[model samples]
Target chain A: MSEAGEFDFIAQHLAPLSQGYEGAFGLTDDAAILADVPGLVITTDTMIQGVHFRKLEPWDLVARKALRVNLSDLAAMGADPHAVLLSITWPQAVRPAQMQRFVDGLKTDLEAFGIPLIGGDTTRGGELLVVTVTALGQCEHPLLRSGGEAGQDLYVSGTIGDAVLGLEVDTLAGLTGVHKAIVEDRHLLPTPRLKLGRELCGLASAALDVSDGLVADAGHLARASGVKAGIELDSIPLSSAAETWVRIQRDPIATLVKLITSGDDYELLFSAGPEKREEILAAAKRAGTHIARIGSLIEGKGVEVRTTSGELVRIDQAGFTHF
Target chain B: MSEAGEFDFIAQHLAPLSQGYEGAFGLTDDAAILADVPGLVITTDTMIQGVHFRKLEPWDLVARKALRVNLSDLAAMGADPHAVLLSITWPQAVRPAQMQRFVDGLKTDLEAFGIPLIGGDTTRGGELLVVTVTALGQCEHPLLRSGGEAGQDLYVSGTIGDAVLGLEVDTLAGLTGVHKAIVEDRHLLPTPRLKLGRELCGLASAALDVSDGLVADAGHLARASGVKAGIELDSIPLSSAAETWVRIQRDPIATLVKLITSGDDYELLFSAGPEKREEILAAAKRAGTHIARIGSLIEGKGVEVRTTSGELVRIDQAGFTHF
Candidate 1:
């Protein structure tokens, strides 16, 4: 823990994050007040040391990952970032410099995302560092997972499986050069796709960010919308690094299945009518984000994945289970 | 941890809390949307095991305390409770039944306050449980700590230092009967004073909940408002139980000073014009809460506690430090 008390800590270190935000009162008030807050979207995420990231990982990167995860949730709901509240549980043993680095990263992202830090509490407790971020967003009509129709086309933004690989980069033998950095960056920091989500607000029927593996998240959309999502295995987009990693494996199809089943992919997945494909393409172009037509939703109950040669892929599990 | 995963846990256990709140999407959506969110007040608090509570503390009371602390913050801002988001980090060793009790307590308070659970996240990891709650409130004009004037009369609601005594009740010999329970309950489950806060809306110039001890919190108000706060030691109100405990101490004045400097008193302290004394009494009466005239704000800086005969009292330390 730092030498400063909670009040001193806020005034000296965290108060700057609230600068330019009138409602934040430079975080001097007991609670922040937003004069106008219509159509607000709220999402929260918690990241812990040793659980979400390695103990030796840099604090700034950890802070970025924590903030981006919450932002990603806002994007999934088709909301633009508005403001944020952060609750940081500092382990007593960590250096104050590490925490300063984390705060610096928060400053960078708040500026980049154009969101202000409103109100939060800092406490010294527990053995592991924990950060819980609550991001409040604005949206006219949030695109929910339950809005999908059977005839709509399934589309996914950016490449998948890279973040999961990023977590295991050090363990994966012979994975070096740009491939290592590419995958590692995905784990350390993620793009929230707020602009892409904004573009899809009216164009797409259903949307969500894929964090708990593509297949498990598809199941979530399916269950919510009372439809089946069928993905063509060959059409699933992969980063060049993942492609290189996959080719060296003995069974490529099995390796691909493993990639899809692994979690931590922060990419937007949505469904739209076939007639709006061109419009979605234009939308993706405007957002400057890569998107691919992966599959389609059908009038059924769950999720299914099959190869071009008509082989069904069996997935034992699709994501992390807390228990 | 339970056999149920995150999705199943939400569906089976937590979805009921979100039933009437449409924005919560029955706790199924990635994020919740509040259609109208003007004049919003946002506050967050994080509580950790072994730090905030004992390892064997009952989960339901723990949950109640967590919820009330956030509510207390809202009350301090003179905002009505609107909604809540809870992020729980579960330990792997805890039984599911304990978590259920916590949920039950949350349900009780949510119904009692007419505040719905709008959104939250649940994750499992680490050796200790952590609960973080973000409360959203509404108010036209939030009562900030900086709104006080030098001539305003200072008042405190309920009694001071009961909670701190409650924490040390076991250690203080011969302290028994109703006094022990009163102090323990004050420590375990504090009243948020929402009604009193609402009553003080336009009446009080500055208001804040006393969480970080009376003297320290008064110092905060003084520093924020650029004024001075002086409290008479003889005029400070205390519960009958505390009066009895004080008489047994070696120096009652020293005990009172100790009480004022110790934290965890969740009482509302505010400043108002002396002309509004009668009106403030009526407001407190209607809210069914006790109020005491303690002192007044003066033109200057910092806080002072004086004996009725006009002698300055010295304080070594006013509150806890994170380090």
Candidate 2:
């Protein structure tokens, strides 16, 4: 079977990326199927030209980012992604060769993540390109934000402030070239903590991916669990570049606060009981990722930042959102 | 769990449409879980403003059409749709109330189809409103276009040409108001012949929805099946309004050809053995829809149309695509 008109180009380009998944049906059928029954986790994310990315960004990277964000959501739910359904609203201005580059990039990551493209739609419309990816996964112990209670230790996988800090090129202008590239790379290609999320399945009490700022997502976790998350400002994890950028700031604590509030961090923010600390560290080690206990969930509401000595750090809060 | 920022509006408005699906989890979790996957069939479609619809189209209808198109794909595969994951990139120009109407429209169909909203993502960007829907379904035996054999009888469920004809207001200007309204309604809201598709699961040798016009889609089915489809021009079913319009046309056959060449008919076109004719009619009766034996597959290639007397009718075949 072959894809019909308007959609033929997609199947011609992407059928190879289906990776022989029996359900993909060579992208010939209008729909794909998953034959077996298991716990299914589904998440979707959309990236549009000019909004989620600059027009000059490499098509491959844009495709990868579009995919990883959804995979990150699956990871946050402690699910291992198996397949994806993509919907691309292509603009007339985008050359077919550019779309081929986009598909090439998608193919690269689809193979890397071992998640095949099972189904999708390709259409011509809009002046701005829009890509929407829905990731499908299966997990035995799915994580949730409402699973935590008071007295749970809040933890984050990998470095927190880097991705957000990576966006502040002006603040990092004085830094070394290598340091600048490190932070910028973090912003461009975020490695989803899939293995770590799977490891935390039965361990973490609550979990979610921090696409919104750490503080904001922490507030979400707290609100969902009906508790307050108290984070020690000094304890937030940072990459070496972030550390260097913060050291030059007149008020280092204020800079750190700003880092935590400016989102685009695809890291996982989660909570677990104190009893699971050793196991979590072990899980992180096995996953080859770092985990830090940045804060603790307490009886209250919303998120609060405090110094190591318990001195409260009141954030300006204004312009904290991306809008 | 509760939804976080950037997606709060989607959850708050459409969460009610989740319809108590366990996987929806109140649209709170980062991803939704479908605990039991019974042969999961998935399909996705996207509609962008100024492309799929005009700026004046009602948001509610736009939302329904978006969902229905994906559902129609599932129907083409002889699957029972169970859930959908929506990704809407809301434009800044679209007011909150307008978005509310979109959700309301989505809610109406979600309930009508009994397909719950399991998961989705909402972000603001672009000057065009983009709505992408990924539908999930279950089917024990999915019908496929490759299933047809040379001798199979080609059948189509329900009328075909009304949708395309509905797009031409100037062509129908001389028609009565009631006749004009009928075709226009068919254009605005297409009924995905889901029940008919489900019934065709075992009976159909090949199947697909007619979104690409009857003749074009027949070409697709024939090419996929490695055979030829010979359609009887007079056998193509039509609504009363279409019949009346064709009667007044200076060239009725030419008008018919034009109608079949233009797309957007969400009807099921399939192939089955003559042995299943009685059974298929019974099935269509049970589905409460009309069925017509329009064509037959032969040991050849591509599609051909003929009159009742077997006279060849050549279609211009240009501008047949919506693009």
Candidate 3:
């Protein structure tokens, strides 16, 4: 109804982003106080409006997506979220309604994950909105992409490439009923797999979150771990919508490979010991998250996809390069 | 020379900036490993090109300026430098030469203060160039702005308003010789009184850095501490350059008032026990710093300046407001 003052804006909109996480003091004070934890893991990710997201997307979703992407980074390291600093590039011509709704979405995600927004900078900038979120996490020993051993089983949480399928279906005409709803939901609200990642802290040998297509991100893991990760082409966990959509158009294998390299899945790609496979499966079930046995880490570099006939297929590149 | 690879860019440019700091692991790893110390103080500030600095400014000066501003915050809280995270929004058109110079400048400041550039994010954005730095420090107990008590002495380290005057001269460009040099230096490099702030940790009742000119920032200290500060206008220290410049211009009081409200004076503004003034002054001298007693904390609601004629002048608003 009216313009909020600077202090009130911070108290209402920004502070709630870091509301309920353990060790994070309430944000009412000038600074957010955090308790000293054992193993602190900190990571920063910046999202630019046109570069990271289309302006056409709802402002509320933009706020959630910004927080989700940073959370995904913490999830990749198997770290528990403690607090985050949100540096926002406030765009000109942003209405009070938009600001309120945007902050509301930010609060929703923060309260859901129990992380508080600690400290941040606000500045006037161009039409392009920039949200830089630095997330602080704690772990006994962080799960790194460099720790994957040869012969370890590679598992991916939830389904892959649903966001891709959702994008395609949302653009095409005459897509109706449950298909439309599912596709839109997948695109708008990405699940960051925080619970699954926390469970995999000790269990996962090496891990990374799928941001840039499965194939590309998996390739990063393989390269970093100094091991080859071989995946069965048919074992990729594709959505029912993706299966139907691909059947109507191109060959499923080609489509699957393309999807793997497409990015924005936000699922966890992790390596665990072959001996621990049964334990991992049981844990995945208990977490209410899927774990698809996609591949196995082998002694070598480079990622190789195998045909059902055991034929090796080479991919040109693993993931998207920002440059 | 050929263009620098991403890894090389990090190793060459960033590694040197992290020198002389206590880091568990530096820029070599995917994530920085920071050892946690209890009572650690953290603060973040973001500066954008065009918003905070001009591109015409030397890369080294920009680097120095950015680090100084963030360091000012830590100094205000009476914290010692430990480590820093530098997030840069790089322009796509920037060549390696430009980046190299920028890195060189950043490295100078990092080395000077013994505050390492531990971790950061670099991303592409629009016309605006953003630099968000999070500086972390350790303190036994931080001197908060809300700690000042009635009957305490309010003091400011070094001189104030020179940086503001420097900004004015840089834009107008009608002055020359020492007049121009002092103003430019003030604008380009405003030192944070780190030693004084840390020394006053236990002795000082409350403290803060004066970025947003003296009168205004003192207002912040007063409001936070729940005590009103009374200032003698004659007690406000004016740089020789500021005084000479004022003599060349119109009414000295008006000019002084204008400079007092112009932001970007990175000096320490703090309150201490009246009895501890001598010890505070001696500690400042040992730290190779200077401080001037400007006012006293009194039982009231707001701040007022007493003139030479014993007239108390009420000044409500102080410094600059970005919004």
Candidate 4:
């Protein structure tokens, strides 16, 4: 087929998928018009096939991950996702069936999340499949990382370190059966805590999604708010599977440090006053998500970690970074 | 350098560039918050290294092209450029100096267009460099391709075919000096008709940008409006350099057809009633851009083109398409 056939493919498979959104203009216009938006929250993320996920991974899960990561950004801001724009570059060897499954995955997520595919661009000629999603959401009271006050207590939702540990299990084959499957699922698909984020809107002082490790992301919150975050290492929440793996490790302290520093945990890490601790816990419980108080913001700079034995721990690497 | 060092690079280079936009939150928050926007115009475009441009093309022009293409979409919607979010995937071999030059180019265009860098993501992977820019604009009254009526006249701004001819010149190495430079520049940097598009908001009933050739894009406008667009081949404007090349060609008719069907003009194409011709001409004059009446919308399906001798012309290939 000629390159122009790409338009035909989009018209056939993708245009109908966007029919639910009137602003999409049947996916025929150069731009999409969004009207009656109360407040717009914008976030974008790019995922490369080999770098972000294994090449053998299912196309549907790949699509879901691409969309959900951006959705996670919205959830961090206490926003309700409304629309998404995707820019994808497919490798020349990609088959039509793979493309169909990918679109199907996007359609499922758009329906499930109550967000519509509004607009996007597709191009050919990349060594790897590259998917970039720009998600737009609405928030009445959008949370900012800079909103954390010095006296506010830091809280995190969901267990940490499962994703990285899942990566290790998948790569090294060190774990067996259910434990491996559980952690691998955590690595493949992250739950975006959307309900918990929305519930924290007026409750939490500041919030962000923990994609780049708890300690590293906390440093961002600290720098933005001009306050230091003092985290208790022992207080960090861990999944039962991760705890089992750590207990078996020779140096449990080292394993715990690695867990706190490993990235790709798409949970909400936020701050609120100590007075509102009960309210925050109630909100998390109502949203059916776990909440743990792991730290407090203090008058200073950067992030500090304190071990259970009253010793300060030094971290060699805080989180994942792209260079 | 460790992956955590990427944060240092972003802080040193990108964060300072985004300081002008208050909503960006110094690029520290998980998402950017856009408040008090009238109506949002969202458009995204992805450019692959080899497919879109030569691999060795200057980094600055590549950056400009990536940003301008999406800005052209906003112009087609008659929206004022507001902000941009970029998602870039660099090859593993890319040097920091190269990255810096690329960002400098983005900085130049962002300042020139008064559009701030709101937020984005950068990753390391892909054999070829890929850049995707999502431009967000604001428009109280936006133009739509579906707004055209059957009796409206079709008009196009600037000259067509220069960009494709420029590509031919670059690849074939047949042209040299000034002519080569002009066509190459046309391909490298598309002048988005922002002022003219804004001026045409209420004057033109329907509008689009001619990135996929004059005919194919006009077909898009036709399909969206449920009307037939009959274009006069002789009326299509050509740059002086393009005219010179055509005059020297063995088969000028074929050349004209190729020129009209060639994509990447990046000029505004719109439809308006014949009664508003004077107003359209005046708007173009005020914007200091040339406007020409190419044809009219008729009662039918698809697009039709007539030669200067009043003979119907058949197009073999309508425009450039990505497979």
Candidate 5:
């Protein structure tokens, strides 16, 4: 028969998925009503096709990335995600199968994180597929980037630069086998350290998700706190595959610089007092996530990187810029 | 000499506007935090260039419409807007000046509505400019479309069909002066009847904002409440301009049918019990908005319309569909 109508499409594929969420009103009402909570943390992120991801990327991964990026923001704030509102602007070329796969991926991640897709809006746009997810989280005292003090130790959860390397591996022809697979997975899916983030609520003085380069994000934290950040080059964490690739490459320093400057890591970059180091480590151990002491907040302003030998490094470009 | 960077852009233009809102954290943190309210209402709406509005439209009106539509949803639920999260996917062609104008327009509405722009995402997309606004509102007891009963009186606030006619005026040639301006204003900028909506919370048994055609939206209310709505075609409220146009037109019945089928009214369509009619009228009077008793909900399914002479009318197209 004729193609399914808009209401029919939503009722068949989307409505059933939202049944358990009492506030969603079965997606029948104009807006969803949420009960009172202690505090609500809200973050929104928009991802565009071709600009944010390759057109050849699977729908599942695309959907997961869109949701995960917002979750990463919530994690940065040390909040537990409660629900999500998704807005999708589908490209004219998108088919029903593609839409189904995208929703399936979203549902998969929502279930994994225990966050319900409460409500959203779907519309038709131009050639690009634009997805925006507004994640609502709860935290009594949400972490702020401005909370860092001058003497705080800057730390990051999980290894960085794998996503950048993954992008390179996908674009380049030389990489192959397990190395490529690992980095590609990192690029396709980012693990938002929600548990560790919630655990770090009272521990981390300042926090943020690393979407831009490490130094750039550190600069943000430093500027917000009116302090300077000093990052030691040798202390920067790297994956085994990335280290192996760095060892094989001719210019190791340039590779390291690229790793530090490339964005899209999605790791929690935070700062805590030096006295809390043991507690931080204990929390990380409990969460089963690695923690790295990469830098320190100083008395001045901006971000400074120190070399392995003790020389201060001057960087030209710090991170990715959309405009 | 070089254009301001993304962070600089946000700091200079966006940060200052968000200073008054304590939860916004001056737009510096990863997410915005909101304190507890009695009840929370969330709504999201997406508008795309060309499809939703002409590219040539002024940035001020475009931004206003984008925000107002989401506010309309909150109003439909009898919620008072508290905060908004905006996600905009800007096209590459957008310049710094254009961006400033868009933000200025958004700021105007935020100030006017007394709602803060708490958080959002800005990214580059393809040719289309896609804007999504997620409004967070508060209400002790929100209105629902499913609350209407069989004997309830169906009433509509303000006027209908002006927006649709406005769209026609923009695309077609003929209309000029006040008529053109009135319809165009209705189409371009919608005033979210927030006061009236909040006032109707205890009075209106069922309520919704008319984004799609009246008959179709009435059908939605009908299906949600498991009752049939009977609308008197003659009772459909029309602006004086629209009424004048109807009187002058050769085929008035077709014009009226088209008006009823056209969408984007943004007026509140509600149902109330006959006993609460006086209270509803008083509420409308207090809110300073016109209310029209168009029909009643019957013990059946779907929506039916009767002509001035008592002849029943059938509509082929109920409402606008995206798919």
Candidate 6:
């Protein structure tokens, strides 16, 4: 079939995603008009193929990951997505079929996240897809990385590095059965912890999503909050299958250490007061999620990783640096 | 020398752009926290090298035009720019020297326009630079293309087709004169009609910026407003040099027709009633700009060109359509 026309395709798929968005204008004008709501939290993230993701991945997974990553940033700030602007760049050319499938996959994710792709730009460029999604959200006193107190407890939502482990599994040979598929799926589609983020907004002292590995992102949170963080290595949550997979790979401790340092976890790392700890844990359990009391804020700088042997491991490079 | 570091580069160049902007959460946080303000307007536009501009163009010119295009859209709604988010896809891997120059140019325009670069995403991709700018503005009642009424006088701000002629002269040889540099500058650095836009916001019934040529964009205004538009060729404010150049090369009338359909003339094409014509003229004078009565909206849908001899010439295509 001929490629879906831009206007028609947008009208059919994009309109539904924006339905019920309280705005004088949503998407049907020269520009999308949003009512000036209080506390507008806006964030933008761009992912380029080969740099952020490999083209070897499926189209659906790519679309899902791109949106999820941006959503993850909003979640870190405890914001609900209001609208999104998608600036899409296709390699000099894309097959009409491929483009259609890509747009369809994107449409599905936008609908799922309740964010309308309101406005953006499209252009031809070199090989690789570059998609920059700018999200407009609303929050009352957005959770900032700088809000953590020195004595506050640090907690993380969900397992730490299953996605990284999954990536390794996909590349290595001799891995078989359900474990491999599960690992690959984890690497492909990471669920942004939106519910826990919303619940922790008022309760948590400070927060940020783990994107550039646990160690690196932890440092970021600490630096932003101007407080050092101490994490007990044992407190880093690992999936049962992931743990077994790491153990089978050789030195389990080393493997786990490497995994924790690998980026793309998309989990929320937050701080909470001693009084709010029980309430936070209860909320996580009710939501069918796990909270790991990984660390606590300290009156210093950087991260201190305490090992099982009670020795602190100092990691200088915390996460991925794009530049 | 090592390339300029990302953080320091942003701090030095982009920090000043946010000076007078309201609620601009600098580059430190996860997102920009915009304070709740009524009557906010948003618009986005993207410029790609080889598609929107040539790589050989000066960095300052590219930065200025990239910003001007988006500003033109906001101006169409009679809004003043508050903040801008730039999503940049570098064709080659980013180098610090080139990046500094690019950012410096962007900073200059942002400061001149009183809009700050609040946030952006940078990614590596393709062989062409893609800069997508999303401008946020605020106005009481945004002027939309759908607000025109039948029998409204269709007018344009400043001159039309100067940029198109400039582009032609800059690319093709044999057109040697002061016109070459002046036209090239016009094509490179367009002054978006921000003042007229603000003044016309409440007065003009319908408005849109002329990006994709006058005829095509005027047609868009007509279609959006559900009215027919008729343009008088003689009334189009083509510069004397442009008229002379066209008269020597081809039929000036046909050239003018093509100019009306050529893209990249960042003028404002708006429709207002005769009652507001005097007020619009006065506003243009106050802004030290010219207003041209190019067309009129009627009770039909299609656009027609009125020749100097009174014969009507219908164009097959209105503007360039990039899919």
DockQ ranking, high to low: 4, 1, 5, 2, 6, 3
Alpha-carbon local distance difference test for all models: 0.86, 0.85, 0.74, 0.87, 0.86, 0.76
- Residue-level lDDT of model 1, residues A1-323, one tens digit each, is 32235667788878888766898988877899874857888999888888778898899888888999999999998899998999998887767788889988888888888888988888786678889999989898898999998988999999988988888898767666799899989878989999999989988999999887898888888788889999999999999999888888889888898888777788998999999999999999999999999999999987889999878888777554444
- Who wins the DockQ comparison? 4
Question: Evaluated against the true chain A, what TM-score does chain A of model 2 have?
Answer: 0.95
Collision pairs in model 5: none
- lDDT (C-alpha) at residue A140 in model 6: 88
Name the lDDT of candidate 2.
Answer: 0.85
Q: Looking at model 3 chain B, report the run of 10 residues with the lowest lDDT sum.
A: B21-30
Candidate number that wins on TM-score, 1 or 5: 1
DockQ, structure candidate 5: 0.64
For each prediction, how big is the interface RMSD? 2.2, 4.2, 3.7, 1.8, 2.7, 3.4
| B1-323 per-residue lDDT for model 5 (tens digits) | 11137777777877776747888887888999986777889988878888678877888788999999999999999999988888887787787778888888988988888888888877774676778889999998899999999999999999989998888785534455888899989999998989999999988999999988798889989988999999999999999878877777788888888888788899999999999989999999999999999999999999899998989887777866444
lDDT of 5 by residue, A1-323 (tens): 11126677667767766747898987779998875778888999878788788877888899999999999999998899988888887877778788889989987888788887788877765666778888999998888999999988999988888999998785534555788899989999999988889989999999998988797889889989999999998899898888887777788877787888888999989999999999999999988899999989999998889888988876777765555
Model 4, C-alpha of A297: deviation from truth (Å): 2.2
Per-residue alpha-carbon lDDT of model 4 for B1-323, expressed as tens digits? 45556777677777887756887886778888875678788999888788777888888889999999999999999999988988888888888878888988988998899888888887776567778899999898899998999989999999999999888784534454787789878988999999999999998999999987898889889988999999998899988888878888888888888888888899999999999989999999998999999999999988899987889998877766555
TM-score of chain B of 4: 0.96
For model 5 chain B, the run of ten residues with the poorest summed lDDT: B1-10
- Ranking the candidates on lDDT from highest down gives 4, 1, 5, 2, 6, 3
lDDT of 1 by residue, B96-197 (tens): 798889988888888889888888888777788789999989888788898888888999999998988988878878677788999989999999999999
Tens-digit per-residue lDDT, A1-323, candidate 2: 11343556755788888889998987778899885858888888888888888777788988999999898998899998989988887786668678888988998899899888988877675687888898988898899999889999999988877876666665676789888888888887888999999999999999999887899889888988999999998888998888898899898888888888877788999999999889999999999989889989999998889998899988766214433
Error of 3 at A173 (Å): 4.8
Q: If you assessed candidate 4 against the hidden native complex, which CAPRI class would it receive? A: medium
Task: Give the C-alpha miss distance for residue A160 in model 4, angstroms.
Answer: 0.9
Expressed as tens digits, the lDDT of each residue in A1-323 for candidate 6 is: 11125445555655555665544243545566666678887777767677667766667678778888878888888888878876676666777666667777887888787776766655555566767777888888688887888998999988877887677675655556677777777788888887778788788888888877888778878887889988888888887767677768867667767777887888999998888878998878765778899979999998889987888875545654444
In candidate 3 the C-alpha lDDT for residue A107 amounts to 82
Clash-forming residue pairs, model 1: A37-B37
When 1 and 6 are scored with TM-score, the better candidate is 1
Specify the poorest-scoring 10-residue window by lDDT in model 5 chain A.
A1-10
